[model samples]
Target: MELYQLRTFVAVARAGHLTRAAEGLHVSQPAVSAHIKALEDELGVALFTRSARGMGLTPQGQALLARAQSVLEQAEELTRAARSLRQQLDGELKIALNTDAEFLRVRELLSVLRAEHPALGVHLPQNMSHFIAEEVRAGSLDGGFVYGEAPPQGLEAVPLCSFRLVVIGPLAWRERLAGATWADLAREPWVWYSDALPCHASVQRWIAPYECRLSKVAVTDYEGTIRALVQSGAGLGIMREDEGARCEGAGEAFVWRGDSLPMNAYFLYRRDRESDPAMRAVLAALRAVWGLEQPLASAHMRA
Candidate 1:
């Protein structure tokens, strides 16, 4: 019945946890419960089921989520339109910068948004690729830039660019890494990514089925950290070609430059947010930052 109740329902469903949804909504848990109860009673169907870990949506709740999100978005748009009629266009969006903000042309993205929507407020937070995807899907973040083979569930991903990921090491090890094979690289002590990082699996796939156990000298998830360790002769590491080249030119490191691995970059957001004008504007700005409109027009996207 009430828009507030519907919002609470949507938040609960998205978070799959009552407390988290309550915190995100900036309301007390009891209030969140009351809202959910009222909505369920009004609709004559149970919307959630309780479990030890959290609350989960029932089939009925799942069915209503899309419709609820659409209603909320439309209502928000109506309010924005009314404000626009008065010559004011106010908006605030939270965006995640996956891995490192430096790698994604972040300044360009901001410039585009500022030019189009001067009143729009933007927040950038550093986050992992997988976490960024999850936050975007849960409506916590507007969108994020990530590198991967594909986007996760409930998201729409558009290709931004493709680049080579290269194996790199300290310049001092140039002789050691030369003509190194997968088996040789694996046998050498290396700077490796933590198992939890999204890039970890991709790095493994880069040398598919090699099944060689790397002698990990240092483990980390941060790209800058990995580069630093690799350049310090901590061991070998995999990184973007441009980054490796920069380090090589600095006389700090050497890129393998043998067979390079390819990685695709993409911008990800929830499909439900597609109808949002601000989100649409953000998407356009992102594409523009990549130097074209619909640059990934033919790129694959998950439904």
Candidate 2:
């Protein structure tokens, strides 16, 4: 029933183990266990099933996990709101990035924000797209650029750029695909991403049946590695048209830009944090750089 209990519970649920969660929270194993036991006793339901392998959330636990996350998120937001009310733009502007495109925008945004809003500080937290979304919602990030099908719940997504996806291959691929269709990309050896990455699921669908038997010369989470593998004669891989242009083999990189595989890059933040003056200036700087300085239309997002 205490805040620490809930925090411990959330950490355990996220880590799916007591020892790891305890280490992350800087607490002892018994302390974590006691907190969970106390929480379960108060709630009158078991949250996790203890086992030799590891802890697994029960049906009740899964149900509580959602509400627990929301509660913890809101609690942190409350603290941030109070802090923002008392002090304006004094803290770091915590931002997150996922893809290379998102990462590329940071230096520019930081330089502009610093020159314009000298009172404000900036922090970059490089992580996957999903974590970027989650941290923004949890008030751990002031703003960030995330790539996904849609925005995370309770956060506004300001569309910055939209790029066309392409299936990229080396110069030699041009000879084999004299007249190739979207389906033809599936027939070749595929070098795909692992998981929890941008466009992984879409890449899977694009490669379809061939993904089962296709040789995965490089299973990488790094975009640079994928590009390197493709350039080093590994196999065909998925990339954005802009990304392909910046990498090697720009002239002979077999690109399928006609496939309308578009993804919207978004700058995300908590809905309540929009009124912060420093945050506004940071956003304005970005808009000025991107030629979107004109007032943005009112948008209330729900994932």
Leading candidate by lDDT: 1
Give the alpha carbon lDDT tens digit for every residue of 256-285 in model 1.
857777778888877777778788888788
lDDT of each: 0.82, 0.75
In candidate 1, list every pair of residues with a backbone clash. Answer: none
Candidate 1 error regions (>4 Å): 1-88, 294-303
| Candidate that scores best on TM-score | 1
True lDDT of residue 266, candidate 2: 81
Candidate 2, position 206, lDDT = 55
Off by over 4 Å in 2: 1-89, 101-104, 204-215, 248-252
Give the Cα error of residue 276 in candidate 1, in Å: 1.1
Residues 223-261, candidate 2: write the lDDT tens digits: 777777777777888777777776535564666443546
lDDT score for residue 302 of model 1: 60
